[model samples]
Target: MAKYGVHQLRGIIGDFSRVTHFPNANLTVVHNQSKRLNQSQDLSHIAVALLVSTLMQERFVWMTAKTNGTTYRSKIVRSMEEAFAYIDDYRKTFDTVEEP
Candidate 1:
């Protein structure tokens, strides 16, 4: 049995969502949020190239952490920041407008 690390979880999520449409699963991380049953699966345009693995145990650590590349990581970070900005704008417009 192959044990997958936390970093690979995003791809796993995307893969799983392609086949199964579970209602309770939070597939947002992979941009596979369940939508209208009659429509086709929605693919989020978000760029998800970086894999930030979750920490499981101290004993099982990667001997040599393999990276796709620093440039890719930077791109991921930039895209994430862009997403945050969009979220902030949406919240300001719809969520916080009525706050006194």
Candidate 2:
């Protein structure tokens, strides 16, 4: 599920960049990171695509994964702080050069 969330976030960033006529290399970096994550996890493309479609219409996303009888959950909420935090972390995660 983390893989799918990153995938959706990348797509949204890319589409926004194109629609606004503002090209951003950081967006591409993030997309590449997500692609790598997906490949590393060996996720199902079809399942991820369907999940991305479902997430497009929703303000909140919740994902869960279970291993060794333990379950983990991650939630993304549509709030100003959450959005900013995600962007900040993404920027740091990929170590992209910031634009002035």
Candidate 3:
């Protein structure tokens, strides 16, 4: 059996979303509350990329931690930022216009 580290917790990273990894599963992070296919896909492009990255890490099958690489680790950073931005935009959207 193989164990994945914190880096393994990240999957696809992109302009829209990120895929978060846990000990036993994956989480797709998206922007906005929309769950429609087109909207979700728009929001989850980054999520998909992160998932693909994770899958690539696993090589679409399985891998031991000893084989993980630093290059792979660097791949997911922007995706997390994008996911945060995606959601942050939504947060701002709900706020009313203020006289500030």
Candidate 4:
């Protein structure tokens, strides 16, 4: 679990030249105070579950994508509780799957 500001997050992503350099699973929370992220930055390859807890009308849009046989999951929510629940459900559903 790691917390980063919008600018810092952008820098981190920009620093990584390859998608494989990212962690297998990541949980990110975007608070109301943070600025809107750059829409061009694609996080599907980074394997992130994003929680947007903001009242702003303009929100970040992300889609699930598979890379290297791994399916990355992402979701946007209005509250922190919903964010945790989403993560918990994802863990229960995917983490328990037996790879064969």
lDDT of 3 at 31: 18
lDDT of 2 by residue, 1-100 (tens): 4655534442121112112222347445645675566567533211211121234323112211121111121224344455455555554544443344
In candidate 1, position 35 carries an lDDT of: 30
Q: TM-score for model 1?
A: 0.24
Query: How do the residues 1-100 of candidate 3 rate in per-residue lDDT, one tens digit apiece?
Result: 0275332332333332233343333322221121333342332212222222354444322232112222322232234555455444433542323225
lDDT accuracy of residue 49 in candidate 1: 32
Worst 10 residues of 3 by lDDT: 25-34
- Candidates in order, TM-scores: namely 0.24, 0.25, 0.22, 0.35
RMSD of each: 15.8, 14.2, 14.8, 13.9
RMSD of 3: 14.8
CA shift at 6, candidate 3, in angstroms? 26
Off by over 4 Å in 2: 2-22, 45-100
C-alpha displacement of 5 in model 2, angstroms?
12
**Model 1 Cα displacement at 50 (Å)?**
14
Residue 66 in model 3: shift from native, Å?
A: 37
lDDT of 3: 0.31
Mind giving the per-residue lDDT tens digits that candidate 1 earns over 1-100?
A: 0375332222211112122232323333222322331134222222223222233211111111112211211222124445455434444554355477
